[model samples]
Target chain A: MQPVEHPKSLNEVTADKIRNAIVEGELALGAKLSEQRLADLLGVSRSPVRDALAALQAEGLVVISPKRGSFVFTPDSHVVDELCEHRVILETAAVRLGITRNPSELTRQLAASCDAMQSALDAGDPHGYTRADHQFHNAIIESADNRALAKSYVLMISPLKALRTHLFTIMTENTDRSLSEHHLVLNAVRDKDPDRAISLLSAHVGHLAEAFRANLSTSQDGKISPATLEA
Target chain B: MQPVEHPKSLNEVTADKIRNAIVEGELALGAKLSEQRLADLLGVSRSPVRDALAALQAEGLVVISPKRGSFVFTPDSHVVDELCEHRVILETAAVRLGITRNPSELTRQLAASCDAMQSALDAGDPHGYTRADHQFHNAIIESADNRALAKSYVLMISPLKALRTHLFTIMTENTDRSLSEHHLVLNAVRDKDPDRAISLLSAHVGHLAEAFRANLSTSQDGKISPATLEA
Candidate 1:
């Protein structure tokens, strides 16, 4: 993976590099991650690579088996389904809390995110669009003003993002429709209708759930590796 | 803080000792946790003490300041309110999901836990009662069959248990009421009514929130510390 940004420490830089590589699908599912091989590939020492692997293990993107060493997380269909359901419950709750606490401010932030997403779509920048999409949801979660909610949401979604790396790339059927859904959620929030906002948010996450299910069905061989058992 | 059980590893034993101390009020809020001091207190070495502190930090029971050593978490009134709100949202969602998926089996498990809780109370063993209480809620979360939900719920609630230690000791006035509430929730789940289960679970957690609020109001110094800011 190509290094994009300079982090404060070499360990952090190595970790982010490896994280980006996994999320961008450069590292295939269930692929073995030898510290030496990664160090050689990234032109870094094995110490930093080891630290990076440990960091990835915490983020749920990598798993270590007792005898088999580390591998990229390769969840089975059942895991994916559970992850999707968890996401729906969490994101819906987040949006409802967001609407309840600060309707006008949350609406304004989401509207700005939506505009940025639209611009990215128009510019044919899927990477930019994805970044903005992540920010949009993060803003909604933060707006809830609940540290525990936000922490739990992050812990649950981080692994799902790794699972979605390739699926998101392939599920390019309806950017325009997704953008419109965002606007609808913003409108519901702006109107201070928590019920409507929650319904829209559920449907929005439901769309991702469908895509994850479809991807899982099409890719039958991507079973959970032995390493994931430790996780 | 006395060692009750031998864990599989030294790190685990050290972590459990510190966790128990914090929860049982042997370690006070804002109390500095020097690695050397903890090691000496626990009759262990500094290495394991440091590892234990790191593990406790992950559980939200300990915080490491930039300049100061680790300390027990000291959440103020606002943080307690947010924590209670988060618990209500998550546990209610969990009960609803549990009701939807495996009502009979979940109801059976919760009933068993209620029996265990009653037995503990009859024996005048508050610690045993607390353990059973935790298992009861854990059963509900796991009944949803979502690993991520269970993980998130554990992550969110682990810290709150510290706040409950003292509150639970003093809030003995409603033991019978809480027991009856658990039975009502079990009945609602057995009846396959998600709404009733959610409402009962919400009220059940609401009682804790009320107690926490009352405690915070009476004890003004029990505020979120600078260490918690670092957290």
Candidate 2:
């Protein structure tokens, strides 16, 4: 993730800075985050830093221990699975509503995203690719014309972004395959096949779950079932 | 919603108090919420009341309109429709997961809720019925055992609860029908029919959307298409 530039409110900027740090693992998960230290590092007042922590807390990135202090959320495989399941449910519904609402527009946006992914891959810019990737799915959700669905989808995906930040390299490794899958999904939408679109979208997200499970097993030597791995 | 009894922190208490007021429409939608007045009314200092307002704002029940101060969120038909659409998506997914993960327990909870609804109907208690109705759906969500889904569902549903508060009588009118529908969906679940359960859940939430649409047309002369009403 990139650091946000100035000119925005200090509170928002500080929150973004802290969030990026946590996402990039500059702040170790489960490690204490002192407001004084963060404020000093960010060259801001403690009040603004405190506000930033509150914002992060709401996002589930930082947990505040009553007696201790704020800490980056320790990764939980169960939480990741839950998040992936949520994404599958939401994105599948989005595909249904999105294509039904305006198949041509949704297909066009998704095709543009596919092109953007190609450019990012050609340039070897994983960050840019990730942004376009998010934009691609976001366009579908937006086209569904359901604000609540979009909002809930975003909220559920936030922590997963943090998870992605941790396994940034692993996620990047799948980009070429992901790009192809994106096009397949886009083609399904273009063909006006909601069932095919939903199925493809499920498999696409389910692929991420596989990656996550592999990472989890490697990191923790813990087991996860294939049944639980279906996004 | 019933008032949460004491033993909670003042911040939690104040937050619940304000939330109940907003949901009950004791505080009108779009009405300015003065911190001083709220503090005086709740017999607390402004600090806790301010915290409560922040909590309420996050839940979408209250809006802090920049320098204009906090206000009850103005009810919006579009938002209600969006919320209903979200409910349909999440609950249908929940029905699938709940049945797949553990059919018997989920069936037991839904059955209990169905009985609760029946009891409330027989007792002529709308408030109790409303509470049971929420608990019923909540059981479905919780039975999915996905914390992220439940949390996002609650946040998205908050404002709709406020809308329900405004049209409490109208909502209660469909109770008997709703209760019957609940049993129909529960029977599908009990029969181990995920597809049937999902379809019924979709229709059940769709029914609410239709009712809300009719209410919206009556209240604001705002038109929503029946086509957009389906999940």
**Interface RMSD after interface superposition, each candidate:** 2.0, 1.2
Top DockQ prediction, candidate number: 2
Off by over 4 Å in 2: A1-9, A170-172, A220-231, B1-7, B170-172, B220-231
lDDT of 2 by residue, B17-119 (tens): 7787767656666777889988887788987787678778878888886557887787677887888988988988998899999989999999999899889
Binned by DockQ into CAPRI classes (incorrect, acceptable, medium, high), candidate 2 is: medium
| Residue pairs of candidate 2 with colliding backbone atoms | none
**lDDT of every model, 2 decimals:** 0.77, 0.79
> Which candidate leads the pack in TM-score?
2
Worst 10 residues of 2 chain B by lDDT: B222-231
DockQ of each: 0.48, 0.65
What's the TM-score of every candidate structure?
0.84, 0.88
